[model samples]
Target: MTAPRSGSILTTYRRHKELLLLLLPSMVLLVLFNYVPMVGLVLAFKDYMASLGMVRSPWVGLENFQRLFASEDFPRALRNTATISLLRLTFGFVAPIVLALMLNEVRVSWFKRGVQTLTYLPYFLSWVILGGMFLMLLGSEGPVNWLVQAAGHSPVSFLSNGAWFIVTIILTGIWQSAGYGAVIYLAALAGIDPNLYEAAAIDGAGRWKQTRHVTLPCLAPTIVVLLILSLSNILNAGFDQIYNMFNPMVYDVGDIIDTYVLRRMVYQDFGLATAAGLFKSVIGLLLVVSANGAARRLSGGEHGIW
Candidate 1:
């Protein structure tokens, strides 16, 4: 029995050899870029002396983490990061679903394709360029401010105010990412059986009924997967966007874990920066795991993210 099972495994592996060969380069890059750098996570627990080097660095237990816990900026930064993340998660989770549903309803092929192109275009723009454009449009003296003045309101300094910083981050995230993320939902929507819609319509169900019953139910699996993935990324508040858009005046509301680490690194506190990074990574791992577990329970033996 064991011999036959082993032979069967070998046969399946051999049959998929070409596919595995195709995946080799990506796996190699993943190991090199993603896995290999994990070794540096140990720096979090060490006193990284400039002259001592990494290997020669003295182990400092949890001193780095202790300092981080006691830092003046830690509490406020954590709150801001969590608030921004939650906002993005709420909006980000719904935008793609709505876009996918709307796209599916568009019967005109050309119009649908044009909308897709327009939506996806922003995803390709560099953060620096997009940030500058957004700043110009939302600046104190920009076109938006002009409109606000015309609307009988005072001009708002979007980039300078801590109160508006988090809102700006969430809005920019939606602008930048909603389209690219919608592609997966669009594909999922496509795979849904149109015959189900036809059947529902034949049975006297209107468009709303069809969408509520057939469309949403069919798309539930994809939605669950996407939600899990999004939740797992609670810590990842888009470093590139936040880093490029943030100013000193907005740091109280805009500084996230990633930006904080980068700041510490630039200031030459390698050990503390590494500790903060490690803290974020550990929380991120727990979140993903918990999300996967919740998915399994909710889906009840259907395909899970794990």
Candidate 2:
């Protein structure tokens, strides 16, 4: 019996050998890039030194975590992260869905394609390039300020001012990511059955009614899944965007956990920075689990990461 079972396992493995071969590189990369680096997370608990190296670094237990929480900047960074993330979750999350729905409703293929192309172009542009463009556009001597001056108004200091800085980050973030986000929703929309729409129409339902009854219900699971995923990254306030676009003036509001960690690293407080990063990761993990659970309960177990 044991020999036959072993033989059956071997046969099954042989049957799917080609499929496993196809996945080998990706599996290797995942292990190398993702899993291997996870070992470095221990740096958070250690007093790291370049001379001593990771192995020789003395473990300080929770002292690094204590210092991280005690730092004045830490609270500010945490607040800013939560604020920016929540704002993005509320506003930025909806833009793509709305755009996707509007695009889905468009009957003109050429026009819809053109609009999609235009929207998607920005997502492909690195924040490094986009930041420079935005800086130029938002500068006092830039076209935007020039227009404001022309209108007999003062030129607003967009990047310098705290309130405006947050607004600018959120808006730019939406612009950069919304199109890419919409692609997922568009795919989901495409997967909806045409028969449902036809049935709704047969029942004398208008476009809005059909959309409300059929489209939205079908989209609910996708929306829930995406929302849960987004919740997991609530601490990540686009490091590339903020690092490139932010100035010292707006650091009070614009500095997120990532930038805070970068700043700590600049000061050579490796353990503190690592602790902050680890804290962020822990929070992210907790948020993911909680959000997944809530989504499952809310969706009657129909939608969740699990």
> Top lDDT: which candidate number?
2
TM-score of each prediction:
0.87, 0.87
Model 2 scores a C-alpha lDDT of 0.92
Worst 10 residues of 1 by lDDT: 1-10
Residue 305 alpha-carbon offset, candidate 1, angstroms: 4.8
Q: Per-residue lDDT of 35-67 in model 2, one digit per residue for the tens?
A: 877888899999999899987999999999888
The deviation in Å at residue 165 for candidate 2 is 0.5
Q: After superposition, which runs of candidate 1 have C-alpha atoms over 4 Å from their true positions?
A: 1-36, 300-306
Residue 29, model 2, lDDT? 100
Q: How far does residue 66 in candidate 1 sit from its true spot (Å)? A: 0.7
What are the per-residue Cα lDDT tens digits for candidate 1 across 142-214?
Answer: 9989999999999988888887777787888888877888898899888888799999999999999999999
Specify the poorest-scoring 10-residue window by lDDT in model 2.
Answer: 1-10
